[model samples]
Target: MPIYQAPVRDTLFVLNEVLGYERYTNLPGFSDASGDVLEAILAEGARLAENVILPTNRVGDMEGCVRHDDGSVTTPKGFKEAYRQYCEGGWMGLAAPVEHGGQGLPYAVHTAVAEYMVSANLALLMYPGLTQGAIAAILTHGTDEQKTAFVPKMVEGVWTGTMNLTEPHCGTDLGLLRTKAVPNGDGTYKISGQKIFISAGEHDMADNIVHLVLARIEGAPEGVKGISLFIVPKLKLDAAGNPGERNTLSCGSIEEKMGIHGNSTCVMNYDEAEGALLGEPNGGLRAMFTMMNEARLGVGLQGLSQSEVAYQNAVAYAKDRLQGRSLTGVKAPEKKADPIIVHPDIRRSLMTMRAFNEAGRAFTLWTALKSDVAHRSGDDSDRQAADDHMSLMTPIVKGVLTDKGFEHAVMAQQVFGGHGYIEEHGMSQFVRDARIAMIYEGANGIQALDLVGRKLGANGGRAVQAFFKEVGEFCEENRADEKMAPYTKALKKGLNDLQAATMWLMQNGMKNPDNAGAASTDFLHLFGLVALGYMWAQMAKTAQGKLADGANGSTSFYDNKLVTGRYFMERVMPETAAHLARLSSGAETMMALPAEAF
Candidate 1:
């Protein structure tokens, strides 16, 4: 079985020391999340993740979810029980609104707990995770009656939710969607469509599955503008708001996927299923963006979570697996050979994983804080600024984290040599699971396109300008400190690299649109490296302060953090220059090849 400790201490350090989360207590819902309260919440969450969910991971993977002939889906053994425990703990509404039966904590707290659940078992997490996103959508766009009828139950985990957008003919191009919603004379619509690759689509875990689907109403304008959102339930509601009649929907089949077998990815068929319009007529895409953005960030977390677990297992294996003698000397002369960890190459792999994981954790949490500010702040300007910053960082968080996450997972697997290749050891499962994060949630490519194409120009470049100003201010503020100079200097260089790439895009992309397309991915990654570099610099400053305060009796922890931050600054941050170079090269070479040449 695989081991998963939730890194609760590390998370607490980020919360208390690095970000100074207590400072935000004046914000709505955060006053109750003081240090002690946060610690207690995380401790219990960690216990649940390690003791309950971790045990079921391999079992869920091997046995998978079974769909019966009657279209009822049964998850692997112990999954329902674990979910029951989760719901009983009030975890489903950890960060939801208080009026909707939620704890009403800040998004930052929700993000921390979710990282634990995802790290323990991603497939199991998806059931509630998707539900949370759906709640966000309905809360943002649903009617008062809709909110009264649905949000509370979802918040209490009595029902789950899903976002149904994909179809047999379309994935990224919502304009090509063919689903239809014809308005019945009363108020409801008759939805007829087939949605493919719907995660947690047909699970038997909850009493109701509220599918927030996108369909075009009759006589609406063509393309994406015509699309409308709907609330299509698995079971129709009774007069008293209980699940009453069966809806005209069924799971056509569950996909035999390469990974996440524990999750029920279904091909759903809706033959005039009774549906009610959500939001407004021809306003589905706008509302659905709410759920998609939430899921995208969660997907990015999935990448980091998989890397963390894979790295943990790999580190343990490296310390125990005997390979060859060290090149420097026979450190373990008593044995025939030293452990693989003693080798320089293995250290490189481990350091790569460590540096990325630590920085990525901080980066994601930082974004979550922005989410809190966007949603809870009293100042309208502050909320708008935070929202813009979040929009700017979303793609980078989703694109770079997942891209590096998969790469790190493969590197960790390589550390185990042949043993990692076998399924019994569980390293391969991490690799397979990590692979999907890069492809879903708008795919990394589309994320890059959004970053370069839409986000950069949004609000006259307010967010990017603010980002540059923020990082520049940090660099300037710490430049004179002897202990922090290295990180500051390295981050300054990365910022310069990112700025140069931005300037290059601005100069070239206007002349040739393909230049932007060709350079967007590299540009997003370049931006991401600098973003993480900023995170490492902040963490380094925190560690430096702690060390200057005599380490507070935790010398090794602070020392290791400083060393890892330095490693990231010295090694990982330099990669931004290469990405800048590639992006600056533009479409000249990339687009030169003829279609027939390949």
Candidate 2:
């Protein structure tokens, strides 16, 4: 089994020190999220994660989910018990509104707990993870009756939820979706569709599954405009508002996927299942995007979660293994060989992991803070600015985090040599699990196109312009501080590179759209590098302040943070230049070859 200790210390640093979570206590739900309260909650959450859920990770993978003959699925052993505890702890409703039987905490607190849960076991986490998204959708867009009927139980964990999209023929192109919804002469509709790749689609842990489904109405307009959203439950609700009769839906089969074996990724069959209109008819895509955007952020966290765990185990192995003698000479002359940690190449790998993991953690928490403000702040202008920031950064968060996250997993696995390849060491599982994030929740390619084609120009580029202005201000303010010089210099350079790439895209992509498409991926990455660099620079500033204050007993922790930030600035920030160069290369070379040339 692999070890996974939640990075609680680093998490707290980001929450209190880097992001100034305390300043937002005046926000609606953040009043109770005091530092001491959050710290205690995090301690308990870590206990649940590290001690309970993590032990089940390898077992779940080995046993997998079993499908029975009755069109039902049973999760691997221990999942049911774990889920019971998860619900009992009120985790599902931690960030939900108080009127719905929830803690009413800020989303940032939930984000921290989510990081722990995902790091411990991503597959187990999905069951509740998807439920949160469904709950948010209902809370945001559902009718008041729908909220009264569904929100409490889902929050309390009696029933779980799933998002049903993507048929066999369609994935991202929801306009081509084929699911059908026929009117039943009442407010209800009879839905008939087969949805594939539905995570937690069928599971025995929860009493009923609430599926927020997308379907086309019988005489509706064609394409995406025709689609409507429906609340299709696996079991119908009774007069008492509990799960009553079984709905006409079943798990056709479970996917034998490469990873997340613990989660029941099912092919769901809804044979004229009774459902109610969720939002307005022909308004599904707009509603669905609310859930999709929330899911995309959660998926971005999944990237960081996998990286944190993989890096932990890799560091452990690097210290224990004794395969190499250091070039600095016989420091371990008494033994056959020195520990592999002594080697420069191994140090490089470890440092790379450390730098990215910390920077990524900061980036995630920063975005999460923005979410808190966007949703909870009273000022309309403040909310708008935060929302714009989130819209611009969503694709970068989804695309860059997953792409680099998987790469980090592979690099960590390499630290274990041949042992990493074997399942016993558990590194291969990390690699496998991280692989799916890049492909799902809108593939990286689509995310890039979204960043370039839509988000860049959204609100007349107000979001991107806001981002540029913010970074420029930070650099200008901190440039003169002697200790902050290195970080600020690197951040300024990366910011310039990002700005140049944006200009090139705007200039060339106008005449030839393929030019934008060709540069999209590289542009997204360049943007991501600058974002992470900005995080590192901010963290460096925070660490410097702490050291200057001589706060309590913390010398090493603050000092080490400065060192890690320095590593990122000097070693990793330069990748922005490479990405900028690629973005400037345009589409001519890429499109020159004929379609059949391959």
Q: Against the true structure, what is every candidate's RMSD? A: 0.8, 0.9
CA lDDT of every candidate? 0.93, 0.92
Using alpha carbons, what is the TM-score of model 2?
0.99
Clashes of each: 0, 0
- Scored by lDDT, the top model is 1
lDDT of 2 by residue, 388-438 (tens): 999998899989889888998999999999999999999999999999999
Q: Residue 107 in model 2: shift from native, Å?
A: 0.3
Query: Which runs of model 1 end up more than 4 angstroms from their true locations?
Result: none
Candidate 2 CA-lDDT value: 0.92
